[model samples]
Target: MREDLTEQLSPAQIIERAEMSKAFRDVFALAGGKRVLFWMLEQCAIYTDAYTGENNSTNYALGLQSAGRKLIAKLDEIDPQFYPELLLAMKEIREADKAAAKSLAEKLEPEDDADIA
Candidate 1:
């Protein structure tokens, strides 16, 4: 019964794996949600003072940066025009995120007038 169960599940598992693989390939090939991908990579690649011989970033962050770089290279190979798209996307997202963060901070902070009393 165990052997039969394994046999029955193998084909379904194989198909599921193939479908997931194709789905991921299509996502990258079509550049769908690539802005989100760039955002994630940008977060991973943040090294602030790492370049200044400071151990500011944790080992986990450094590892993420290394892996993110390899993924970036693969993305570049997949789309020769990726760099320009990445540049534009990064700039737009950064500005939007910065504005959103500032707005949220303003809403969350106590009023200066209230504190002055």
Candidate 2:
């Protein structure tokens, strides 16, 4: 129940995040993957928000959007129809994550709570 939104991540959390980022970069390194990344960046840009201190959404979104545009422009790419596929994949992942979180939360809840009520 940490109230601070800007609390620093644990080392393990940081490593997990870094690994995820590296995985994305590895995917982007593949042929035609830049287009997929550019599309993802464009979608993500709008969701950025104030993070305080070192991180600013305005700057991050601006940079992300700019990089996305540059990536797409670099190849003069054709329409890859990435949106539909990515959207579906994201939806599935989100649902799985939600279920996992719910299961974890239930496990962490006090065992005596129901008896108390």
- In Å, residue 31's CA in model 1 sits off its true spot by 8.4
Tens-digit lDDT string for candidate 1 (48-112)? 42353555545666877787777677666446566567677667777887999999999999878
Write down the lDDT that model 2 would get. Answer: 0.57
TM-score of 2: 0.42
Residue 10, model 2, lDDT: 78
Highest-TM-score candidate: 1
Model 2 worst lDDT window (10 residues) = 74-83
Residue clash pairs of candidate 1: none
Model 2, 45-65: lDDT tens digits are 634542435657567767766
- The reply for model 1, stretches above 4 Å from the true place, is 1-32, 46-58, 93-117
Which 10 successive residues of model 1 have the least lDDT summed?
46-55
How many clashes in each candidate? 0, 0
